[model samples]
Every structure is written in C-alpha cells, then in structure tokens.
Target chain A: MIINGKLVVSSSPHIRSVESVQSVMTDVLIALFPAALMAVLLFGYRALITMIIAVLTAMLVEAVWLRKRDIFNDGSAAVTGLLLALILPAAVPWWVVVVGSASAIIIGKQVFGGIGYNIFNPALVGRVILVVSWGGHMAGDIWSTPHPFAFGFDVSTVTGATVLASPEKAVTFSLPEMFIGTIAGSMGETSALALLIGGIWLVYKGHIDYRIPGGFMATVFVLGVVFGGGFYGNHLMTGLFHLVAGGVMIAAIFMATDFVTTPVTPGGRLIFGIGCGLITMLIRLWGTLPEGVTFAILLMNALTPIIDNFTIPRQFGGVNNSA
Target chain B: MKAGNVYLQDLSRGIINENPVFRLLLGMCPVLGVTAFFINGLGMGIAATAVLIASNVVISALKNYIPSQVRIPCFIVVIATFVTIIEMVLQAFQPDLYEALGVFVPLIVVNCVILGRAEAFASKKPLLRSLVDGIAVGIGFTLALGILALVREVFGQGTILGPDPDSAIQLFGAGFEPMGLFGQPAGAFIALGLLLGVVNIIFKKFNIK
Candidate 1:
C-alpha cells in the first residue's frame, strides 16, 4: 500500500490506532478509581490495604511467573488485582487478598496463555475461587458497616447484611444512600453512583462500549420489576433497587465490559450483557446465593467465543446466493 | 531391544509415556468418581489393579481360544469375574474401604483400563508381557489417583487419607482455610486438567512421544 507517495508494507491491521494495551489498561485503571476511592471512603483503611496487597501481589506474581521485569509497568495485573480487591469484603484478611491476587494472575491469566488468550476475566476468576473456597469470609455476615467520611477509623466494628440479602431493608433505605454507597456490601460494589462515574469515563474514553452495561442494567431492571416482589409499594422502585444494590453496578459496568473476556462485536456485547443479567437475576431470585454478579459475568465470559462466532458480521456481499 | 530392556520399557511406559489417566485418558470413571480422598483413591487403585492384572493374565492365556467376533464380550466376562472377586474380597476384609468405594468397585467392571489392556495389549502379547503391562499400567493408574486425591484432600478438606475429621491427617495449620471447592466434582476436573498439563510439559521436556 502507498500512502502519500510512500510505499508501506505490513501485515493485517493496516490501519493502526494510537491506543495500545498499556493505554487501554491505564484508562480502565483510571476509570476504576472512583469506585476504589469510594470503597476506601466507606470502609476505611482496611479497604486500602486490601487493594494494595492485591495489586502488588498480582503484579509480583505475573512478573515472577513470566520472568518479565517490566510487567508491573504494563498495568494489566494492577487492573486485575484492584478489580479483585474491589469485589472482596472489606473485612477480609490480608492473606486472602494475596492468595486471590496470586490466583488471579496465575490460574486465571497465565495458565490460559495470559492476557488476551484468557477466557474469563482474571479478577472475576479470582473472586469466584475465593468465594468458593472461603464463603464465610467472602459472603454472608462478612459485610462491614460503612463509616463514610470517618477515614482512618476502624469501620469493622459493626457487621451488617447487604441490602440484597434483606430486601426489607431496601424499604427503609433510600435509593440515594445506595447510590452514594452508604451500605454494607463488597468494598467497591456498594455505590451505584461511583461505578456509573467510572463507567461513563470508560465509555467516553472509548475504552468500553455502552451497549454492554446498558443491556445488562435494562435486563436486570425488567426482571427485577417482574420478580423483585414490589418492595416499598412500587415494583419500579424495586427494579431500581435491584440495579443499585449488591454487585450489579460494579459487575455490569466494569467486570462484564472487560475487553479480554467480553465479546468484540456490537451485537455480541449486547447478548453477553443480557446473558449476565439473566443469570444474575436467576441466581439472586431462585438460587441460594444473595448476589450472583461474579458468577454471572464469569459464565458470560466463558460464552464470549461462541457469542462472537455467531455474531460475527458477514462481509459486504459475502453471502452465498445459491445456498 | 534386550529382554530386560523390553520389560523395563513396558514398566516405565505405563507410568509416564502411556499413563492411563493423564496420557491415554482411559478409565476416567473411577479417576473422577473415587478420587475425593487419599484412602479412597488408594483403595480404588488397589482393587482396580488386582482386577486389571487378573483380567490381563486370563485374557492373554485364553486369546487363542477366544474367537475374534465375540472377543469384547469374552473380555468383559473375564474382567467382570475379576472385578466381582475383588469386590467380594474387599467387602469381606475391608468393609470400610468397600463402603467408601461403594459403586465404584462394581463400576470397575466397565473401567476402560482393564478392557483397554485386554483389547490393545493382552490379546496380542504373550502372557508374561501382558502381566508386566498390567502391573505397570495398574501402578500408573494408582499413582495418578493418589496424586489427584492428595491434592484434592489436602486443599479441599485440609486433610489427607480419610474424610472423617477425627481421623483425618492435618497438613495445614489452624489458620489455613480449606478450599471446599476442591472437594466438589468441579475441582476434580481442574485438578485433572492441571495435572495433565504438567504431565504434557514433562513429556515435552524429555522429548517423549
């Protein structure tokens, strides 16, 4: 190919964008900051400590495993580690953070040939393993009461149930509180507002598509109204409650929209999002678990290849006429 | 090859090159079913090994008499007879293991390993070679089961050898939490996959076919 009288010889991907993996990952990390900051603000220093341990452990594990000195600079491991920590209960032990982070890097990413080759989101994989292995710590009464603006205070004094666990609590708890994240839940998943801020930033940066989160939240809203039992004398409020409560916001916005694990095609992304919403609501309604966002995203991640294969757009005039 | 070298190759091949579980992936029923605990795996392995050896010997000796058309039924009959004998012996002597192994002991009649050897090796080879192959492959299956069970038990239950908490072997300290998922069927698959990957890498490192 010739451009401006200069001959260019290259393989496919002839038109290259300025965006690299590092830049994309960096944008994701930046986008995740609002939730991370909210987590620390709500849960205090323990959340900060968990996030640090997770990110450091993930980077160290990847570097040592790959024997790549500059792996920490790439920002993927940091994103994975931060994401894992975000989904964990703020009261979890430091060792849990380390183990989860290491597993995220090793079994989730490296064992599957690393980075783009991995089928599931590395953070969700780690969180799922942690949840399975240590349910007592990851779920149930592990939720700590948020002491917003009380930074450096030990916020682990009071144990509480997430709004999703006790839907009756949603009747008294206003939607504004849930949006601002003054609730008991996983570190980064409590606040719908923070996640939306990050998600919007990501969308604006062109790092993630809006279709995934839009489809996911829409399905959850529709199903939540139908099945959420009309809390606070209104089914629509209950639907909005489902959107704001538990891990729906974080998962729909951040985890399900992960570049490596989610579908690439526009149609496939929407399908993947809807699938996540369906599984999440199914588990939340009928299954034993209170929240199903992690499992839902992971399950959808496994189907990404199939979704992409089916949703691959045909080339212009490529269809057979005499089939 | 020399007689001793041929025997040695036959022994080592089953352990590594043609490992029934990791290599050929034969007899997955018991491999997945009875490998939740170390003792269960050991018991299942021994029972399956005994049946494998007996069946191999009988099938190899009767190979000339057995017609080709009815070979599979004949092989199954021989294998089932051995499996029944082993099952009865375990029930009489080691009832605890018999109960723990449960359906797996009876299921061994259909385990592909025994019939696989009968069809692939025993019916074609001499009695001595068949006996050696049986022992070697049996040991390989036992080793694979033991390794998988050890990983599952130690990680899943924070114990080894037994499922009972009182008699269980504690490898981890009090603070160390057990990964309960490893005790589930899903864990079996993950462990098997990882072990298989490791085996493949080792084979590649040694340039083994």
Candidate 2:
C-alpha cells in the first residue's frame, strides 16, 4: 500500500503478508505470556528472575554466535530462552538457567544453522541438556509447590515429589487446583488451563495446526486410561491427571508443535503426534524417569524426514508407481 | 638424500595429512570408546601404537611369503598376535589402565588402524619405510586421542588425570561444577565432532588437505 511511486524490484510468484520471523516469534511470545504470568504469580519473584536471566543469556549467546551486536536479532532466541526457563524449576540456580538458555541458542539452534534449520525444539534441547547434565537440579524430590497470588513468598521452602513421581502428592492438591494452575510442577507447565488458552490462541491465529496437538493429547489420554491403572481413583481421572501433570501440557502445546523439527505434511503431523504420545507414555509408565516429553519429541524430530516421505501423497488419477 | 626426505615425509604424513582419527576417521571404535579419560586415552593410544609398530614390521617382513588371496586373514593373524601380547603386557604391568580400558584393549585387533596400516603400508612398502609409517601413524593416533581426552576430561570432570585423588590436578578449583554431560558417552561424540570441525577450519586455512 505504501509503494505508490517507489522503484520496487520484485521477484516472480510473490505473495505479501505482514507476518515475519519477528512477528511469528512475537506471537509465540504473546501466547507464552499467560503461562509465564501464571508462573510468577504461582512461584514468586524468583521465577521472574529466572526467566529474565534465561532470556538475556539466550539472546547474548545467539548474538555472539552470529557475530552481530543486535542481541534480539529476530526475537526467536528470546522465545527459546523464555520457553526454556518456563520448563525449569522456579527455584533452580540462576546459573543453570543461564547455561540452559545459552546452550539452547548455541547447540540447539545455531549449530544446526539457526532458527528454521534446527531439527529439534531449541527450548526442549536446552531443557534436556540440563536434565542430562544436572539430574539432581532438574528432577527428583526438588519440585517446589506453587503458591498463587503470593509473589513475595519463597517457593523453594516447600518441596515435594511431583504428582507423576508420587500419587500421594496428587491427594494433597485437588483436581480443580491442578487444572487452575496451582500445582507442584515446572514453572510454566503447571497450569493446564493457561497452556490450553495459549494453545487455543496459537491455533486461532493459524500459526499452529490442531492435528499435532489433538493427536498428541488423544494418544496420551488413551494410554493413560489403559496403563495409568487408577492411580487417582478411576482410569478416566488417571487419564486427566496425566494430561495436566508434568510437561505434557506445555510440550504438546509448544514444543511438539515446533515447525522446523516436526513433519510438514498433514498426514505426517498426526503420526508424529501419536509417536510422541506413545514414547512419552512408555517412559512415564515404565521407564526410570518420571518425564519423557522432551526426549519423545526429539526422538520423533530425528525421524521427521522419514515421516514426511511416508506421508507424501500420490499423484491424483495416476497409477501407483512404487506400490 | 631426496629419497631420505621422501622417507621422512612418509613418517610425518600420518601426523596431519593422513591422520587416522581426524583425517581418515579410521578406528572410530576405539577413538570414541577410550577417549573419555586422559590416562585411558593416552594408554590406549600407546598400546595401539605398540601393536601398530610390531604388526607393521612383521607384516612387511612376511609380505612376500603370504599368499595373495588369503592376505586379509594373514594380516589379521599378525595384528591379533601383537594385540594379544599388548593386552597381556598391560594386564600384567598397568592393572589400572587395563581395568579402565577393559575390553577395548582386546578390541585393538579389529582397530582398522593397525589392520589398515598392515594392509596398505606394510604390505606394499619395504620394512624400514613400514616402520617409519607405523611410528608416524601411531604418533598421530596417540596425539588425537590425547587431545580429545584432555578436552573431555578438563571440561567434563574439571580435573586432569582424575579418578586418582592423590595425584590429580584440579583445573577449575572447587567452585566449578563440571558439565556431567561431558563425562557421559554422548559427550565423547560431541567433543570429537566439535574438535574435528575446529581442525577442519585450521586445515582449510593452512591448505593442509
């Protein structure tokens, strides 16, 4: 609209839009806000501090990698930093958050040729690096209880095993409380309601396809109903419990839906979702670790090319050449 | 005199140009396996070098006698003999390194570096040239392993020559938290891969390849 008399040099077959890397990443940032707001409200100022440190570190690391002075560059590093911070415990040491953010940018994003070229969710990569490197800090009976509306109180004082690790902890908090964002989990992943709101926003904006999240959630529910084995009174409630607990909500909503790492075809997206849920349930129900969302998505990310090939559509009205 | 310089080049080639680990990527089995610890990597490198030298000298001496069709099996027998001898020597003398390396010590027989040199260099060249090649390649492999192990150990464990408290020197002091990832098996791959990238950059800059 503004190119009234300008010398415009345009290429063939071009479609214009206001959206860009910055805008899309900004949308993701906006969607992540409710969960982040909920984290600070639930955890305290420490959560806010951790998020800031992570974002700053991620931006700094990416800038250094690109050899550019502009720290925010295209803002994807900020999105990665915030996402990585949200998955970590609120009371985690600041240095761990800094390290995770830096690694997310450098190892996860840049090493593979930056933002759109990375094969795994950068935030999840950072989280997994922290999980593998510092198991004591990342997991175990160190999860701090969330105290909603109390910003000044220390969250680290009250620690307990996550509901996934011990069903008894689930009894201490009701189903409604868990749904409403007051639960002992990661900083941003506790509030299923908040994450769902963000997911709905992302879906409404057409930035994310519903099939990936839908298939992922459905499979997790089915497996939980079958093998979760009445951990919280009934099989169906157990299914619901699995949905809200751990990193399932945040992972299904944000991490699994990563555009670069996931399949591009419509059919392949569903398969990828189902595969993630299956591996996640496998690890949660039987594996030594209480959570498997990060590893599940990453493992499937590694198979994206094969999944895309398998789901490629046949030419219309043509004989099946390979078949 | 030119022939002597040519022989010297043969001895020096493996150190950079034909490096087994960095250049050819041969014997990855041990390169990835034993390079996690400084002492283990150096010991493994030395042990394999010994096997390489012995196997190279013996294989070149017997090249004319060995039948062409069964040369592969003949080379294996020669390499395996030296590997067994080295394994026994390590087990008898350096029990700690033997324990650290464990099955990797016996794994040198299949190490492509030794068998590769035996087939490629020793079998074709004369005994003296073969000996020189062995020394060169052995030094190269040892240097690569030592460098890789040092990188992993310093960052992963925060100490050089660790696992023995009395003589270990801590590089970062008590305030540092070593990245436990570097100590894991996956860390070995990442460290070696990054090292190769840096080496490639240097080689490209210097036009070594």
Candidate 3:
C-alpha cells in the first residue's frame, strides 16, 4: 500500500498500531460527544452553530491547502478542525472561526511540514491567534447570549445565567447543575462530568497516554485545593468548579494530550503536565484573563521542544555530561 | 563580493536587501514584543539602533585587543555598557517610552542582531565600515518595526498611535483609523506573514534571486 507519497517496505513485526488516523479522529469526535452534548444542552443552538462553523471552516481550509499542495487522503487537518471547533465559544463569529481554522491548517500544521512535524498543538495556536486578534471579544469572558436547549424541562432561566462572565451568577448555579453540566460556557468546556466520562473512555481505548492529563489535572487540583483552603466543603466544591468550568477539563484531556506536540517519555509528559498546570493556575489566579487553560496549553506547547530535549531517554552506554 | 564592496553590501544589505527582522529573521523578540503601536515601535527601534551602533563601534575598536576565546564575553560587556546607558537615559528622560519598551530596551544586550553583527562583521572589518554596517542594519531593523507598527496601528485600533497628541509626538504625523485586528499579537504575525510575502515577491521581481 502507498502511504503519504512515500513508497516503502518494512520487515516483519510490522507491528501496526490499532489506532489508524481515521480511527483516532473518529474516536476523538466520539469522545467529544459528551462535552458537545452538554454544551448544547446548556448553551443551546448557538454552541452548535459555533462548532459547525469552526469545523467546516477548518475542513474547507484543509481541503483547499491539500489541493494547493497536491496532497490527498490525510485526515489530520479534518481532525484538527473538528477539535478546534469543539473548543471554541459558541458565540464566536464565523469569520473568527474561519481565520482560526485557516491559521491552524496553514501555519500550525502545513507550514511546519504537516501533521507529526508540527511543533505546537494546532488547536491551541488557532485559539491563541483568535484570542489575540479579537481580544475584547474573544478573550473577554462575555457571552453574546445563551440558548439553552431543554427537552420540555425548565432551562430558559437555568441557562440564561452567564457562568463564565459573572462569577456571582456562576456561584448561584447549584453543585448538581454544574456537576451534571447545566452551565453556559464554551461549546465543549462547560461540563466537567461529561469530559471526565469521555476522558475515561479515551483511557480505556488506549488512544492517549494518560500521564500528561493525569499529572496536569493533579497539579491543578492540588494547587487549587491548597490555595482554595484545602479541599473540603466549599473548598472542594470551588476546586471542582475550577476543574469543570471553562477549558481546564477539555484542554487537560484533549489539547494537552496531543501526542505529537507533547513529550514522549513518561517523565517528560509529567513535567509538561506539571508546567501546564502551574501556568494555568497562575493565569487563573493572577492574569487578566479568566479562562487561562487555552493560554496555559499554548504556552506549554511552545515549551515542548525544550521539555523534550531535557527529557530524552539516555542511549545505552552513553555517558551523560554536565560540566 | 569584493573588499571594497563589503561595506556598501553590509549597509544596503541590512537596510533592505538582507534586513534583520525581514530577511535574516533575527531579533524577533523586540520586533514582536514592542511593536504594539507606532511610538512603541519607534522607541524600541531607536533604542536598538543606538545600542547596535555603540556596540558595533566599541567592539570594532577593541576587536584586535580582545582574545578570541573571550571575544563573546568582551562583546557582551561592551553591548551591556551601551544598553545600560540607553536604559538610564530613557528612564530619566522618557519614562513612558521606557515603560513601553519595558524589558526589551535592556534586552538589546542579548538581541542576536547586535551581537551577531558585532561578531560577524565589526570584529573583522574596519571601524568605518562597521559603523556604516551598524547604521544600515539599525535602519533595516527600524524599517521592519515601522512596517509592523504601520500595519498594527491601522488595523488593531480605529486610530493611529494612541491619541492625537501621542500620535503627533511619536509617529511623525502619520495617522489613520485602526482596523482592530492589526494591534494585537495576531496582527503582528499577519503583518510579518504579509511582509514576508511582499519581500519575497519584490526579491523575485527585482531578479535579486
């Protein structure tokens, strides 16, 4: 079989991994279902609109670029586009999503020699570009409006409260409401519970290395609990709020878990996760932005090379030197 | 290509032919970090130019006296000295520009363009050629900043520079309504990308290939 323009032959043990690109992408989309469902449930048709626009724009850009470069059959761009769309706030304009999708596909993926060669997470790059370009609109924790979809249940008032922009309003969201994913936020970032469910599925499928996400969440929780007065009662609930709210869960489980951009070794992934956690917490605590998980993931993505360099496994019989 | 042509080459090359930020892609930290608006760009560009020129001249003067092994260290000291002076002067006279430039002004000590020019050209060339090269490269750096600011100012905000008085004082009377996308960090990249594309087209058209 011809593979990606290169004709090659390999010896037996040709141990093929079960996770094909298509399978992986499909699995990721499946994994996102829970979060996407929660987002639609809480935020309504607007979230759906945002996700569709983001995904379509990304895919169209990818297809155009592929045509321009005379390459076909690579599905990574589609995966990236879908992933980026799922992460964005539903209220973001189609133009913003288009710009992001184009940037991610052209600059983050294709410009850096495509797919495995990309140094940073394409979704984070797209998100950051969007944030920086439209700071007041994108970064500011403002919601255009929430369109909560309830199947005959009373969600008109339940979802009207802007959980991200107004902390006072968010505070009023009952623990059960927040836990069961009844808050308005980014299309795939509101429901901590749904994300956790998907994360467990991903872990079960062995599609992702668990070290990074586990370490990242651990760091966020530990630091959050410590600063939040030691994880009991209000503190526990608040810490959980930080965990479930915004992009922390989505990023920890999805974006930060990107295989190519993240470190390979267990220790490297651990360090990467810890760094992401620290930066995310710091930004949440001190930075002007409210949802810092995007920035944190982007910042850590930029530092992956340095992390990889330090965390590279020692060659057998090679002497490590530090003078 | 010849000894006589080297000086002319270095000067013109830095200005446009082989611009640091545009062509060589050196000293990006300041170019991106400082070019939020027009005046910020001008201040950073000028500060960088001053340090570049001073460091090049001093390094050229002491090139022969310094040992080959310790040349980098000696160059740092010279560059650092000039940077310190610039920082102090900016702090005393132009606190706003100083704050605007922030750590980037002091960061000139490590700007690869300054040190790179010093080590690559000035250390070997005569003082006059080195000075010319420094000025040219500095001009080139300033030009890149100018382009970045121009794009950023026009797009990011509805007005050029900050306010009317600020623009008049900082941006040499060039003003325009901002476009919103040009002032942010993403604007920086878009500007750089477009500039790079333009540079390539110009280079190809001029048969400078």
Candidate 4:
C-alpha cells in the first residue's frame, strides 16, 4: 500500500481533507436555523407546531425504516427528517406530515438503497408526494396570524401567503422585504437573509462546494432576467424571493448539494446546478404549479449519474483535450 | 391440427401468460400515461390491438420478401403505416376518443409488444398463425389495458362506467361518488404496480412457470 516510496497505510493521496459527515450535517442544520426562525415570526405558533411535528415524524420514519433494514452508521435519517420539516408549509396537517415522512423514507430513501444512496433529495420527494396526494389540503387558504408578545409592530394577522400563491395578483414586495426575509412563504423560505447567512456559514465551514450554489443561483438570476425582462430590481427581487421562498434556499444550500446525489466533478456540478435553476425558473414563470424547485431538483437528481459519466475528469497525462 | 394448435396458443398467450402490461411489462408509457379513465384504457388498448394484429399479419405474409438486413426498417414502416391509419380513422369518426387517446395513438408504432411479437413469432409463423398470434397479443394488450383502466377509474376517479367528470350517473341505478385520486397520475402508478403484483401472485399460485 505504498506509493512512490512513500509508505502508505491508508489509501491514495494519503492527504486527509479536514471535513466529516457529522460536522457537515451540523453546518446544514445550523444554516437552516435563521430561515426557521423567520418562519416562526411570520407564521406564529402554528408554524412552530408544524415544524416540530414534521421533524419528529420524519425522524421516526427514518429511524424505523433504517432499523427495519438493519443498517446503522451515518445520521442521514435525521438530516432527511430535518430537511422535510423545513420544506413543509406551516399549515400541513399532522397526518400529511406523517405520510409525507413515510413516503420520503420508504420510497425516496429506502427504495433506492438508503440514506446517501438515494438519487433525489428525500424531503422534496416527500413534499411532492403529499402535495400530489393532498393537493386540496396543502394548497388551501391557511395563513399564520400574529401571536401575543409582539412589539409596537402588531404584525398579527398578516394575511400572508407565498409570493407564487397567486401569480395573477400584482406583487408589491420591496427589495428590502425580500432581502430581510420577512416574506410570507414556506417554513424555511420566509427569510432570504437567513438562508444567505446559513449558506455563507456552510461555505465557510466547507460543508459544501461553493460552486454549486453560486452556479445555481446565477443561472436562476440569468434566466429570470431573460424571461422576466430586464426590470432588474423586480426580477432580481423575485428571483431571490423564489430562491428564498419555497425549498430553493434550503434545497440549494443543503439538498441539491448532497455529496452522494450530486455530481463529483466541478464541471458536472455546474451543469447540474444550471439545469436545476433553469427548470425552476421555467416552471415558475409558465407552468401550472407555482413552485417547481422540488421537481427540478428531483429531475436533475435522476440525471446526476449520467452527468457524472459524461464529465469524468481525465486521467493525468491521458487523452489530449484538443483532440 | 399442429398449425391450429399454435394459432390457439398465440391467441391465448397475449391474453394471459404474455399480457403486454401485467406479464411482459411492455407499453408502460401508455399504460401509466393514458389510463386516467376506463374509456381511455379501452380506446387505447383497442387501437393498439388493431395496429398490432394488422402489422403482425402483414409482416408474417411479407417475411420472405423482406431482406434480413433491412427487416427492422421494413417492419417499422409497416407498423407506422397502420398506426397512422388508426390515428386518422379515430380522428375522423371518434373525435372525442381521438382527443382522449392524444399522442398515444401514433406512439403504438414504438410499442414493444407489436415489434416483439413480429420479431419473435410472426416472422417465423405461417400467415394464418401470424394473424392468430397478432390477434392474441393485441387482445392480451387490450385485456391488460382494460384491467388497468378499470382499477384506475374505479379507485382514482371513483366512477366505474360513467360519463365524463363534468357529467355523472348513478351506481347500480343509484348515485356514485368518484375517488378522484385514481384519476390522477400517482393513482395510475399505484394501481399499475398493484396490478402487476396481483398478476404475479396469480401466476405463481397457478404454477404458470
């Protein structure tokens, strides 16, 4: 197990990179905290209840499935549970939460081997399944009214909903509102600021390669400009809103960057991220459904293996690139 | 007697042992895509069966005349011609069913069941036997589609044999409530999966190995 007279006991390169699965998972959870808090502020007590319920349900589902399969090593189940909870709307019913978690764990994760082996993000799969099965309930008119202990703001009964909830209605949200992350949306999408904060932390900690989020958001912004016209501020704000609003921020920072599911090479990752961004923008602009990030991520997830195959890094001193 | 036996075998094979959807797992794109309604399933199955049977007979009769090197292209041309004819006929006479069948009508040319039967059975068989084989396979495809449609219609949309969703009728001469989920794509997948499972079990129990 030696290389070039360098006595090697472990493996190739023998230069260990300073990153572990637990730390990376922790960073992801930490990154999501700000968005979670903003969701609490906007949606009030109900959001908290749903978040707790979703997280616990997801965890239980993952644990039970993992135990049944008799494989225990990584804490991926907890991540799935956490991600699922974050992506869910505050108004999602307890039963739906349970069912969604089960679907994510059983079909999304377990069916395709398990944990890191899943092709698509488990949380997106769960959310989409619930959305399809219980469309009426999930998409119904339910908003978080304000609670007591409010400052002079009296922000109660914001009559709030996601930006994409009604595309026909004229949206007048300012850049500051979107930037500060006070927008009305999913549990993890209330605050763009919070997501940015978390994303920065992930990058600093080296939990994820920065190129993915950078590439993905850039593609989204470019596509938004191209399709939505050069109303730069409005388009930028909306694109950022879309990024922050539903699962985009959470997905981009955490889910889409899944080590096992995403492409290994830098070029492949760029292509994958751009594809996700473009698809999401298209669906948002024209498709029947408002949010397409989850579907886009899943579709790209299915293509990751193929993308890797085509973008494999050349062997050192191998085939000429010009040729 | 031997030739007759083979024809009978081919006829029965598609209906049961080699059911295009449940047994052989062929033509899944349409099975899952178009089985939103029972009528849709029936229409699609019948249309596909027609193309399958006609193409099989034509290919069988012309087997000798076709060059081995160019047989696939020739078979595809034959199949595509029948599919186009079916598409046009449906469009002209049954516009509603035509609308419901949609792009699937033309897609029958690519359906593996028709091509598979031609390559495996028809080319080697006599004209009479090939016709029987085609009919059998077509009916089998139809039966599978029918079963899928029945389950999907009953469970997803909650109507067994009724008018369109906008229109309604009674169940057993009374009123009926549809399970609208069955009308959706997810329900189609679950129903198809369950049907595949049930067919597998029945085959196992009957020792159809």
Best by DockQ: 1
lDDT tens per residue, model 1, A7-113: 77899988988888899999999999999999999999988999999999999999998898996767899999999999998988888789889988888999999
Task: List residue ranges in candidate 4 displaced over 4 A.
Answer: A1-34, A37-41, A56-73, A130-159, A164-181, A218-247, A282-292, A310-323, B1-12, B23-25, B50-95, B103-112, B126-135, B162-209
RMSD of candidate 1 to the truth, in angstroms, is 3.0
Clashing residue pairs found in predicted model 2:
none
**How would you encode candidate 3's per-residue C-alpha lDDT over A256-305 as one tens digit per residue?**
99888888877889998988889998887677667677878778878888
CAPRI class of candidate 2: medium
Model 4 agreement with the true structure over A1-323: per-residue lDDT tens digits: 55577554776787867666766676677777776777677666666666777667666766675675532235566667667776776666677777777777776787777756888788888878777766754553443322322333333335455666664331566657656655555656656677788888878877788777777788777776567643435666555545554557766777788787889998899998888888888887788877788888889999999999888777788877743
- Candidate 3, residues B1-209, lDDT tens digits: the string is 68769778877888978899988999998898877677789889989999999888988998999999999999999999999999999999999888888888889999999999999998998899889999999999999998788667655654456634645433333443233556666668767887788888898898774
Candidate 1, residues B1-209, lDDT tens digits: the string is 59989889999998888999988999998898888899999889988999999999999999999999999999999988888899899999999889988899999999998999999999999999999999999999999999999988888988876786677878888878888778888778878888888888988999998
Q: Write candidate 2's Cα lDDT for A20-83 as tens digits.
A: 9888889999999999999999999989999999999999999988999999889999999999
Candidate 1 vs 3: which has more TM-score: 1
TM-score of chain A of each: 0.93, 0.94, 0.84, 0.83
Model 4: how far residue B1 lies from native, Å: 11
Superposition error at A296 for model 3 (Å)? 2.8
Please give, as one word, the docking class of candidate 4.
incorrect
- Model 2 stretches with alpha carbons more than 4 Å out: A1-14, A315-323
Worst 10 residues of 2 chain A by lDDT: A166-175
> Candidate 3 at A173: error in angstroms?
1.4
Among residues 3 or more apart in sequence or in different chains, the pairs in candidate 1 whose N, CA or C atoms overlap within 3 Å are none
What's candidate 3's i-RMS value?
4.1
The lDDT values for all models are 0.90, 0.89, 0.76, 0.73
Order of models, best DockQ first:
1, 2, 3, 4
